[model samples]
Target: MEVLQILHMNKGNDETSYAQNSKVQRKILSVVKPIIDEAVQKMLCSNIAPIGSMGIADLGCSSGPNTLLLISEIIDAIHATSSCSTSFTEFRVFLNDLFSNDFNTIFMSLPAFYNQLKEEKGAGFGSFFISAVPGSFYGRLFPAKSLHFVHSSSSLHWLSQVPPGLDCQAAGKALNKGKIYISKTSPQCVLEAYSLQFHKDFLLFLKSRAEEIVGGGRMVLSLIGRSSSDPSTQESCYQWELLAHALMSMVSEVNT
Candidate 1:
């Protein structure tokens, strides 16, 4: 039993790690690309020339292979937008994420991405200035009305932490008794805690982005979401469920 428990705990840790890694900020860029393009087109149509150093940001930017890919798309969108107009302004990008994120990986990749940008000229894909910002998107990470465009994906769904009011006793019993994710039969306290966290986080996201984006600036967000309005439907991605199961398995193993 002790050996089984240890194995489950290790499996859970891997599952959780896998879940976090696969949900980087870049995955949703394509989903919102059309919106970004339209926003850029509008800026051009409005004669916003010399775009005056447009500020772009990617929030909840996790460290992974996909991070740089999204940055490139954003630069392309900006230049495409700028080209339609006469804007020749230098572009500055802010890549934002939590302090604990693997910023080192992002930083190390910058020189190559920057050098490539330097090589392109007189095109939307050309030059761009980039910086990695360490912070949470839920808080004020940018200056007042400083951003012209913002992008975030697979990030907003994350609660800062697990909900506080979850009934540990209930959660423990569920795992010990061989239940999976909190089901419809789960305790209301569990569901309420999760719902409140999501609601609070969503509101914070709106307020912060609203304050940072200029009056006509654009903001794009893509995230994992529940298929139904009901929180107990358990229709989220299988990866998420696998991670949750791993967590419970780990907990039960340790107790044995």
Candidate 2:
């Protein structure tokens, strides 16, 4: 719980904050733009089309330039594909993140975002209703069939809590020593616990999203992950292994 207390990006436009270090996420979104465009195009053309308004949610939307980028792209796609048969009159965009997220920063930067939108799409480019939604994405966040499109980027690695492990070497002691997550020396049980927790979390995410999205709605998820099944594999965990080595080397130097 103590760790959870401080689990948010740094506030303001600081050098060491998520706002300044999210270019990689922006590029990923650019790479997936075609996919989003196709999905939005199809959703707009669906028989149960967007009538008067459309509901869109950007889950795990950190405060920064990236906050409104997804919504902007979605709006562009819809407008580009719009005709007499399919045209939007309004948009309700939900910016979702954890309770600890830097929401104030987002609100502060919103004036610029709106101005940009207005300049690009005109003042009456479908009444844009933006709101903040604070919560974990592991459970239901919206009403049933309430969303037309949902997007999350550069998240999904964070667990809601420490995964329960049965194989404690001693009471309240972790089986994996001196490692925050799966390591080369971690027992098989540690891997199992982490995997089980991931499974449960992913299942919960799907169940919750299912209740919120209509049949033809679309969801895009971007996460930093590996393709390997083995947690200790080099390609899967070299970053952590290198970090552990660097930290241990520093400690050894200090001890000596």
* Best of the candidates, lDDT: 2
Per-residue CA lDDT of model 2 for 1-256, tens digit only, reads 6434567877678898888998998898899899888888777777655536788999889888788788889888977777632456878899998888999988987888889888998886577889999888889899988898998888788776778763356556759766667878888988888889889998999899999997778888878777877788878667877787788789889999
lDDT of 1 by residue, 49-77 (tens): 34477788888766655677777776666
- TM-score of each candidate structure, all chains considered together: 0.77, 0.88
RMSD of 1: 6.5
- Count of backbone collisions in candidate 1: 1
**Cα deviation of 217, candidate 2, in Å:** 1.3
- Give lDDT per model, in order: 0.66, 0.82
| Residue pairs with clashing backbones, model 2 | none
lDDT of 2 at 91: 83
Candidate 2 off by > 4 Å: 2-6, 49-51, 84-87, 170-173, 243-256
